[model samples]
Target: MSIEITVSELYDLKETIAAGLLEGLTYPWEALPKIHDFIIDLGESLPKDIYEERGEYIWVAKSAKVAPTACLNGPLIVDEDAEIRHCAFVRGNAIVGKGAVVGNSTELKNVILFNKVQVPHYNYVGDSILGFKAHMGAGSITSNVKSDKTLVVVKGEGISIETGLKKMGAMLGDNVEVGCNSVLNPGTVIGRNTNIYPASMVRGVIPAGSIYKKATEIAGKREGYF
Candidate 1:
């Protein structure tokens, strides 16, 4: 097995309220279909003082700042101190972790964003799971569907996993940085602390602690890089 492709390798479960849901699965994308039900069950257990049920199946932390102009759908949760900026569209089946930022015009659907993650400008993230502290630069987006609408397949060095679904987006490991205007193609898996170049079209599984220039041009990061 490629350890980097597993849920335990890509994310710190403690950083998310969805830890219980994610922990039971080997791959992060496996949690996508369960997010709706998980949020409903979890929201009922959240402390009343901190989290408020805003609408049917929607919970928002009292400390989180949500813009009045934002369009939020059900089966969603915004954790403590998070920010949902102006006109952000949350299309349901989502979790925004503590201190995370969903910036202006960003759209989310069926996603789990771990603590302190940021998709802060004009981003469209769907059917994805972002690990702790991952940041997507302006205009970066996850392309969740293949052109032919076939089942997504995860492929990487000496590893292949058949994900029996047609709509799987990128899984970004902890502290991954996606540069401006980048597009993560369907079934993409980026590893921990890796950096992606701006405007790049990325696919497949990129290893941890590397810099991606292109599919054929990847460079390992210097030792001790934070």
Candidate 2:
């Protein structure tokens, strides 16, 4: 049997409380359904001094910066030093990690952004988990639902993994960089230390340490220069 990409290999659960709830799951998509409950539970445990409950299950850290125009709903936690920029919309069940940036016009829902992650500049990230320091460039978005409205599946090297989810999104590993205007289709899994080219439409599993120039043109990391 082929070795499946476990959650531990692609994410550090300690970074976000919601991610920790997915301890035994093999795929990241499995955590999508549990986000709402996880946030509600974690929000109750956050320290009052560091986090402030702002109606319902919405908890925003004292030190986090949120623009007045931003609309944040319940079951959300914005960690310390994180920035929710102008016009940003956080629907619910979102844990914006420490020092992360959700920039102007960005929309987030049911997502866990690990520490230092950036979804800056008109991004739409829903039902996804962005690992530590992962960054999505301007205008990039995660296409969370397929046109057919069926359960999402992840395909790898001649192997298929059924996610049994209708609203799955991308699972971006640590240090992954998605370029401008890219669209990560439902059930996309981008491994660690990978860089995707601008305007690329990506789907399926992209292995670690690779450079994705396009959906069909992926290359290994480059060797050291002279």
Candidate 3:
């Protein structure tokens, strides 16, 4: 099996409480279904002084900034110093990591956001795992369900893996930058430090440290002081 989309390959597990759960797991998407239960379990162990249990199965850290207009559902945890911006709709089963930003009008469901991840502005992220410091620009959305409603499949060059899930979203690795107005099709797995251009319709697996211009036009990135 390829290591490109694996938990160890795409993420720094030390940045998330799911670290222990991800151990020995090959793929990062394997943690998606278990997020709700994991949050419930982790929420119970959090210090009462730091995190407040809000209604059933919801824990919000005392220092986190949540706008009054934000609609937050249950089985969710907004970690310390996180920001839930205006009008954000979090529809449960989410773990917003520390110092992360769930920005204005963003909608999230059944997702695990690693520490410092930013899904700011008009975004819909569902059934996905975003690695640390990943940022989605304005109007970017993850199209979780296919029109046919069949099980989602992860497709790569010369390989296809069945997920058995009707609703699956994009998996963004650490420091991945998705530009404005982009639509990430279901089962899109972008590797670490990749950048998708604005208004792009992205699908399948994009390798790490790449700049996705189009399906046939991916470029390697050079690191330097710029």
lDDT of 1 by residue, 37-151 (tens): 9999999999999999999999999999999999999899999999999999999999999999999999999999999999999999999999999999999999999999999
- Candidate 3: misplaced stretches above 4 Å? 1-3, 223-226
In candidate 1, where is summed lDDT lowest over 10 consecutive residues? 1-10
lDDT of candidate 2 over 30-69, digit per residue (tens)? 8888889988888899999999998899999999999999
Among these predicted structures, which one has the highest lDDT?
Answer: 1
For every model shown, what is its TM-score relative to the native structure? 0.98, 0.94, 0.96
Could you tell which candidate, 1 or 3, scores higher by lDDT?
A: 1
Best-to-worst lDDT order: 1, 3, 2
> Cα lDDT of all candidates, in order?
0.94, 0.88, 0.90
Error of 1 at 180 (Å): 0.3
Among these predicted structures, which one has the highest TM-score?
Answer: 1
Error of 2 at 120 (Å): 0.9
Per-residue lDDT of candidate 3, residues 107-148 (tens digit) = 999998999999999999999989999999999999999989
**Candidate with more favorable, higher lDDT: 1 or 2:** 1
